[model samples]
Target chain A: MSIKKVLTGNHAVSYGAMASRVQVISAYPITPQTQVVELLSELVADGKLDAIFVNVESEHSAMSACISASAAGARAFTATSAQGLALMHEMLHWAAGARLPIVLADINRAMAPPWTIWTDQNDSLSQRDTGWMQIYVESNQEAFDSIILAYKVAEQVFLPCMVVLDAFVLSHTSEPIEIHDQEKIDEYLPPYRPMVTIEPGKPIGYGALAAPDTYMEFRYKMQRAMENAVEIFEKEGKLFGDMFGHSYDLVEPYMMDDAEYVIITVGAVTSTARVAIQELRKKGEKAGLLKFRVLRPFPFEKLRELLSGRKKVAVIDRNISFGHHGIFYQEVKSALYPLSNRPPVFGYIAGLGGRDITVSDVVDIYEDMKKRETLEEIIWKGVKL
Target chain B: MVEIRTHGRGGQGAVVASKILADAAFRVGKYAQSFPQFGVERRGAPVVAFTRIAESEEELPVRSNIYEPDHIVVLDPTLLSIPDTFAGLKEGGWVIVNTPELPENLDIPAKFRVATVDASEIAVKYGLGSKAQPIVNTAILGAFSRVLENVIPLSAILNSIPEEVPVKPDANQKACEEAYNMTRIRK
Candidate 1:
């Protein structure tokens, strides 16, 4: 039986990690992400979760510790936010290149020079090239379930997974979610049994030195594992749905079957866009939403399949790639580029530094997409200037 | 769906009050969500929190701050001086304020229903917080349940107090009940 509880997105991640029976948690406290590890530490101290809660000095050390723990054959986990995530940049590469299946919950906080602690996608989107499979979630429930699913898929592919949630919007927001029973979760996700581990007295070397003769092979294998993860994610997602009744996918399409104009979104913005789509549909506008759940592995084929003949496509990105289009906008346009009859993909940047994107704003974007005959470099929404 | 926004200073349990309202709503089999907007982490600074209750999860799909609220709860009466306090409030909405003065004495617009309770005095009477800054959140919520009875029941708020307020749960509950009885409304 599943239990329902009102939980903050941060606490949901904590409960999810605990239910997954994570053996090692090493994370430093960061705004909008601290509550995640705070609850985990208490659970470990109270004996509810039998795990080692390592106290790390910084985000870099946090990821480093997770790397060491996973190397020693433990189900490792950590949580961090914008600057902390940025600090873990080098170690993120290290964890992925070493083929340790570590799971991280990155509360999406905007990178600071102005020093703000608000929700944005730039933080996690900046790490797109670090070889970590990133899954941006829409709600607190998905944030919790993704932890277990992340581990199931990551361990199989030997690549790290980053479960991303909007800071404050989801991180601090409280919502009622169905908490799965431990036994059922355990049945769904078996123990992480890595093919290699650093055992005592075994004296096996790891990450020694890959010469040019073999350096390319490791990259090739990692690429193959990533490719393999696409199928594994689909299978595990379906199986999780069969067990828990909530199914997930690389992309979730809403009202898109006959949608003439489609709006693409990621993270919490998808929820707002969903409301916009419903309102638009009621008004006789065939608007639709395609929510991107899995950022990594790109799902280019799925994008092409879903968006091939749409009249117009609008991609709302909370993160901007300076001097260029929105990050997701670039990805969507690139994905549809190969199609001979692909509709025009409009790029929009909105809700950066934690601005609230209202449903009406989304409707405006749909209207803007309809009026535009050519692509603009970037369509700025909700900008004061 | 009913949307509520709470205004208070830091250390006044505004955020906790939002969560407790959501928890109370959840206890009664409603889909609820609560969150806060914090400018800074210092006491005496203004803070705002939001609670949303709906018949089902699908009714609460917009994951953004509540702009237009059906009701507003003022834990600190001084917050009323700020224009943002009553911004975008719907006509005929409830304005539940924690003040000793009756609803007629308050300076709010007449279009909205006003309910006033001396929550600060009641909270101190129960020794919930310091006399200087008594935690009036529970009392305000108690008044909320009474004035907005159709939205949430007092019994549900009473049941949720212990679960949400770990320290001096009895005191908070007593303050809540007292404010519920003492609240004066101008419909």
Candidate 2:
């Protein structure tokens, strides 16, 4: 039985934590993510939620608190954004390397060059090197579902998970999200049965320095677990589909089966792209949208299959890769680098620093895709020519 | 899916208000989400957070700003004049603002449902604080409870406030209960 009420993306995350019956939560007060901690604290205080809400001083300490709690066999959660996320950089790798199945909601805020705290993918996207499973959600419901699924996926794969919801755009925006039943969730996810436990009786040493000879194997094992998570994500997606009657894939295609020119994007831009494609189709352009939900795995094989026959493909990236192009677009072009019937890949950078990317931007990308006779390695959108 | 937007500054607990609303909704068995839209603005910078509660599937591909909101809860009345805050507000949608009196000087679209309360004054009166940053979120919520049908029960929201925070459990809860009984709604 779902109730009808209005809630923001941050609240949805708290609801997700509550539904997951999160054992421990700790987060510092950052602009976009502060609400998440504020609400969680209230829930813990009111007895609406049964969890230990740690009052941490900074985002770094917050993640540290969650990591320690998770290592102690608790389902730990936390939230952060932008500089706060950057502060957690070293520990992010540490948490994943230690194989603590902690789930965090990173309210995606742009790092300051010009001192802006608006929405952008750079903060989390830049952390791709960290051995964590990352998922960018497009809507409020996805934010809720992603957190719940993240715990299950991380625990199953023995890795940490970061669920990225674009700060302000998705984070502050309100939308309806279906909250799962506690009984249903418990049925789906049993109590936290940690594969690795640290107890006084057992006395396990975590984060111990390894010898040079054995460090490679530890790193190799972490990589292996990430590879394993691809399968785990699919399995969990299947189970969530079975329980909720809605299915989400690593990649979601919108009218792309017959698309001659496909526009690839991530996050909320995909929604605007979908609307743009619909309007474009009415005008007889074979435009389509491929929403990349799973960014960390970099669905190379799927991209190859979809890009094989397209005349021109454009990648709309919200986060830049400095000298090259959009991070996801660079990965997409690389994925198609080995294909025989590879389409000409064009990458466009838009919506940086939380600047609103409207449907017009999507149309501009599709229109560029249609007009290009030869492909350039990259094309920047929303840039002054 | 009904979209909701909240307007306040960074220190105002606008974000907490959304989450408490979400918690109450979830308690009654509804799907809810809350998030904050903030910029470089610190304590005094205007911030907006949102909430969406619905009975069915939440459509993906959301926008940053709330267009056609079913409800808009403004924690700071000053924000009303600073921007086109109500530019896309839906006709007949509810607007619960924390103001002493409905600003008669401003051009308010006629079709909107309006409710006003001096939440800051109430907060001070109840010993919330001289600044009254935290209590407004709860007072507006309690007033919202009275004005918006099915928003949340006062008991549920009161129950949702933490017993630990002296401001929330004692003064904040009293502020909400008082605002709930006192606020007048003009449709």
Best by lDDT: 1
Off by over 4 Å in 2: A1-4, B1-187
lDDT of 2 by residue, A192-212 (tens): 888777888888789898999
Model 1 TM-score on a 0 to 1 scale: 0.99
A213: Cα error in model 1, Å: 0.6
Worst 10 residues of 2 chain A by lDDT: A1-10
For residues A296-362, write the lDDT of model 1, one tens digit per residue.
9778888899999999999999999998889999999888888998999899999999999999999
Candidate 1, A359: how far from true, in Å? 0.4
By summed lDDT, which 10 consecutive residues of candidate 1 chain A come out lowest?
A295-304
Candidate 2, DockQ score (0 to 1): 0.28
Clashing pairs in 1: none
